[model samples]
Target chain A: MASSIRDELLKVLIEHQPHFLSGEEISRRVGCSRAAIWKHIEELRHEGYEIEAKPRNGYRLVYRPDRVAPEELAPHLQTKRFGRHIRYEYSTPSTQTLAHQWAREGAPEGAVVIAEEQVQGKGRMGRTWHSPPQTGVWMSLILRPPISLAEASQLTLLASVGVQQGIKRVTGLPIQIKWPNDLLIHGKKVCGILTELRGEQDQIHYMIIGIGINVNTTSEHWPEELKKIATSLAIESGGHLHRATLIAAILKELEEVYQEYLNSGFRVIKSKWEQAAGMLGKTITARTPQGLITGVAERLNESGALLIRTDQGVIPVYSADIDWKEI
Target chain B: MASSIRDELLKVLIEHQPHFLSGEEISRRVGCSRAAIWKHIEELRHEGYEIEAKPRNGYRLVYRPDRVAPEELAPHLQTKRFGRHIRYEYSTPSTQTLAHQWAREGAPEGAVVIAEEQVQGKGRMGRTWHSPPQTGVWMSLILRPPISLAEASQLTLLASVGVQQGIKRVTGLPIQIKWPNDLLIHGKKVCGILTELRGEQDQIHYMIIGIGINVNTTSEHWPEELKKIATSLAIESGGHLHRATLIAAILKELEEVYQEYLNSGFRVIKSKWEQAAGMLGKTITARTPQGLITGVAERLNESGALLIRTDQGVIPVYSADIDWKEI
Candidate 1:
């Protein structure tokens, strides 16, 4: 359904939250078929909305919009602090831009900036992410990890494990992680992570981790070219999912993983990321700024660098685009 | 005299700039002594103000505010691009803050942000720089150097050399450099360079070089404690100096040095910074976040890291605070 129609449907449902509304009345109000209204209610159920239904009386709201506020998720946030201070906007240019300003203004660590729609959602390498409204989850988290400039890259590896585990736990989907940190399902990308930081020679002042996940976005949200590579959770699972619940689950995992990293070092994250990426002994090409090197993915060294064994020797890749080579 | 009095005196001189005003009349208009008026005029002359003095007349203005505008200095900026798009403010919180916003908004490389006074100027390690009005060069330069994250520290070393040479050429002051770039004169700090960058894991998006110089400030500008460590050009040179001339000279040298870095690597900057800082073979203590290690300063390695020869072995220091040992 169109976002405006869906919003109007939601408004009509909310207006009659105190009493039940008949199916014909709701269908007329929403300008849709009764079967379409039933489908919309199912989608809303998938989105964490509890709509109680009866055979004759009609459907009544189990939770009102004011009671279960989706915009303010702090009370429902289960973690210690990750999403405790979250700001939700209906539309924005980019959440990363606002996160930078907020981080500089001394926002606490674990603060999140989320938006329903992004006109110019940013991607890696100065690219743009395709972000639609009321479907995917787009957010930027403020983090102040006690790490040096050289060790900042490890956080990217750690975040992928947290997010992958969270997705798997929430929807029971078989989410996999690629090299560095790209979440995938069935050989298609489902999420992107953009990590940016402002730092001196040795210390990182703060790091903003921008995450865009295709939670309930459908095929119509992506362009033709992106459809070949990008997939959403709803498309993969054939059912819609709740964005706030998924966000809360990811923050909980991320908080634990981050604390584990600070307490026990990257040892746990290293093992988890290595298992999740599953590129050991595979032939791949790393396209780095220095140049391209086709080699076998040997193993990750102590500092979380991908040490690739090439024809000449083992070259460690810091940051690059990994391409699979079929022989 | 106060800044208000100086501005009022300049206005009075400009009101009768077509002719000349008598000393008594000028002094009466400014509400100051004739001797004080003569001292202020001499100070103005030293500040690159072309004041024509006659026998019976007081003084005639040669450069009106609009005739020689100080804010839009594109004409005076000699480099191909550096400082070509300059924004001069009478007062601001911090030039670095503004430069970041402009850089993100697609400000071209070599764009400069200069201010007369900074109420909350920034310093390295989260300290505040003392920036006074009309007597210091407080500016931030936007740069898009083709470099990696590991090599970004070389820009700081390169900038110190440019600024040091510019000071020498403009005022003939014997300026020296400390490690990582701190400008000193007579064993006291005279200037500071805070190099901040925004980058990914391997590629740098842009770097902002914030330079603060105590150009012609008097001893009264510093607080009771800052007087022990901070000194200015006027205090050491026993004369006032022009702010814009010194700024242009620095920008010229910096542009050249930055170009050399992009063309010839860090070869020129390495030797120049080594000779300027004069830390080789000196017994010093490096206070690093890992721990404090007292060793002899050996040499700068290929990646621009300082190799310190300790009793145990040779350790490379990327960033640290160096304390000298007299023995």
Candidate 2:
């Protein structure tokens, strides 16, 4: 496959880092023709990777971009097929849109769509997501789960847990998950998960889980509009972050979590999410389309719907915009 | 809109009753050009209606084919927009598949996809539906309801009720809705409803409800395999039934039930469904992926999940294949 060749070429480039490797040497090392090596080098350059080639000295690794490439990131990722089938776009309207289209066209499960920037990214409640170029992880994962639409919400919770674990593993940052789908770092939003599904009656054709993580962004990276509430992993960790490594970790963790979810149901992931949840046992105001409901965030039910202990009763909040009061 | 022309033409044709008007006459009556009339008539022909045209006698009605078409049935339809926006296909793999595609491409609410035949029609549990040409109603409706996926099952129940009402209205035959999503006549399945949804997190994007009804099919018309279990409207009514009229009634009833469901919760519709449900208070065996659940079919919950009162407990069945026992 072209991807395998690309991966092999990337490995040789990383191994011979900071050195100029002659085209003949690269061909011999990678077991390919010199012309093939040249073609791959040109392709890498087109993918926004920086490589310098001299007439006699051959190719030099000038700079490796932070964008996620299967070749550049495959060595770090441990998942079997979750991130194996990926569509990397420099710019897209929304990863979710592309993922949805791919799923409808019979793209395999675990296929991913990642973008350097999203011109029309979306969050929950039809809100616009701010995805600056090369600043955040704007990706969507395609899943074909044999579950009812009611039970599909469990995937959102599973993704939240995976994201929390991935952030912790990659950057050693202490992150917490807000009940529902927000991932928070030091009490500010760092990531959000949006799960979409296509199904008929009992059969789920496919599902697209879109995740947006503010990885390498700073307060200045965000518009003045979102600086107050939004936070990035780089800002929270006080350093520059590797987007490729983080993406690989996230996909690896998601594969494991998704496997556990399918095998054992949501009980295991639900407990993990509850432990990482920041707003459990806290009073919150939720704005639903019907009306506003004030209640204590109790816990997630077996089907992954949020159970809110309200004055009226234990209302199962299918969807709502929750605002937690500072305690 | 072009749909308005199709609707007006349908009204005139239905009023004429087994008679055909020339293209010039229809164009003059509809205040459009003869070319426009020819175009609309061609559109109707594509939807599976058989129209006969001559040089001197002009156009004569050869046969009103058994199919679902806006032009052939729209005059009889009373819905506002449910059946107004229709995509009629001669053959599709499945209406649900096409409806999902249309929904993703920004198809309006109440839009419909009707096919003369489904090459690969499907039922619950991967069962193949028998959709013979012009002998059944294989249609899918696009609905943009403001409800969670958990509540989407309610649409199936509402659709069952609608189908039951529609059949009764047109054929004056008493039909019973089998607990989850089937319409039965004399304990034989005459219709099935499959409800699907597209959503992100808690917000639902669109819901596609596919309905298959055996219309104008006699015992000889059915395959030998389905002769004992499936009965058509014609077989039940002891005469050939007009497919377009029945489709119009179904769409009208579906529109009404959908509107009522949106305005109100599933409480009222659930009660009506319970009254017409054949398996209510009867011993039944339901086969689910988890295991077999045997109990007396008690009622339907708010979310339209079937409530079965077993000796062990009252279990809520999201989806299952049911078999009723003899009283």
Candidate 3:
């Protein structure tokens, strides 16, 4: 009930942002006393909502926190279904695991799970993601597409395209994709996408695409190993960006790309992925479970395999960790 | 407590199946009073176990019920892992659902869920399987194999081979496999296999393989629609067969075949599948999601796709319902 009152208060404030709603009117609108309203407003301020209060005119929403809390995100999200139903966590082991839980519980398609901090953030192949509190956009989205098992990999590529376009729109940085689904700026990793799925022999049941973006995350806190390979939007742009705005931008872009995929297929977005990839004709080494193979990364084929030219042959690599040499 | 006592009493009786333990010895072995032992014995008889009580002998195992219950299956199962833990439901919505539940709770690989009746038995592409009570073997098993997504379908083929070999060994009835994973006898389906999986972009997390075999199910109990297309072991053999024995036979064959698959790969089992399939050179029609395609059945490819020689050309089918013309 207290949460509902807060939500109501937030709704009223956001609806009339930059304009004052008198305290009595706000109380009546939220069905709370003026004293209660003041308390919640102070609580909101403590949660990083900047509100301005004058003598006669009661209160106006000045700024929103860089939080991905549903209220902070609802205003910036323009997508129909992507961020409309968000399960936000202040702290969690992994948003990917939460997304899977929600998906199993019949969460709607395109529902989102966002975390301010991931104590045990996940990366591809069981690597720690290192997501700090309110410093990165750590999220997972649920998707259910009627595609074959073979096409599941294509969805990962599609998500990479979304992240590339999203980071471009928000930070004006040209993000390059590292073959399967990692986003980089100036050859330093900024975002990683891990696509997990529930499927049958011939069909995919559901997919959870976990996207972790280092937005406004400072480099001083990075582990020594990550400092060499990873970079953040704040570090690259030399400014702290609004995390809520960044997530909204991503969800908007992702929903559009995902709808495009469902309407036609992955072919329309294939070229977009390739152009952002920039891995073609680059000297690369891929670490596979079988062993390591150094080759010239040729192309990402229609089937989502990274085709590489090696002394052995032009091999289509399915699953691997890629290391590309800088130009 | 009562269930454990029943298990203990069954163990004592089975150890002396042809013989008999005196009431005092039986009560002492079970650590229960003679009255309590007699009550459990009566309950077992009510559940379809046939026990003889002579003047001096406490109990003689006259006959064992055709049940896939844990105790009934314990001695028959010859596998090292498969069916090591049996979850028996006298009636359930679907064993597939229960298996998923247990799996989510960290049930070990090779744990089995069996149901006497499936109120909502699942079939491929959202069809109803129409499983009836205490008649057929409707079961699902959990598997965790380090296999690629493309190779998941091959597991179904391996399972089909297990079912074929099992049926052949148990009833001496030569069973034929439809291209992918259906078992047929005299042109009627005797079993259906559905393989579901949970995976990420790089690796498969787990796969649930649901196999429903029509053993000892009479025609009178079958829904009208299934009468023409489906047949049971009892209907085909003109006599009821032991459901537990058949389940054990399938588990044994499945464990051996599954182990071979894990050790070597599906290539070793490919020829075995082909030998049992008998689908090549037959005029066939495949009803796919796109549309129906008529052709001569060519062969099951290495990737587990059913290659059909259509008028357009030889095409590979991943998911379809088959309609084959009789030779």
DockQ of 1: 0.24
Candidates 2 and 3, the one with greater DockQ: 2
* The candidate that achieves the highest lDDT relative to the unseen native structure: 3
Q: Provide interface RMSD per model, one decimal.
A: 3.2, 2.0, 2.1
lDDT of 3 at B161: 93
Candidate 1 Cα lDDT to native: 0.80
In order of TM-score, best first, we have 2, 3, 1
Looking at candidate 3, what is the lDDT of residue A280? 81
TM-score per candidate: 0.72, 0.84, 0.83
Arrange candidates by lDDT, descending: 3, 2, 1
Q: Determine the C-alpha RMSD for candidate 1 after optimal superposition of all C-alphas.
A: 10.2
lDDT of 3: 0.86
Candidate 1 displacement at residue B214 in angstroms: 2.5
Q: What is the TM-score of chain A in candidate 1?
A: 0.79
lDDT of 2 at A202: 65
**With candidate 2 superimposed using the best TM-score fit, by how many Å does residue A208's alpha carbon deviate from the native?**
0.7
lDDT of 1 by residue, B1-327 (tens): 113556567767766867888889999998999998998888777766678888887678786332212432433457988887777787899999999989989888998898989999998877899998888889999998765555667787889999999898888877888777788888778999998889765567989999999988888988999998789998999987767778888999999999998888888889988888756788889988668988889877645567899989998776677877331
| Number of the top TM-score candidate | 2
Single-chain TM-score of chain A, each candidate:
0.79, 0.90, 0.92
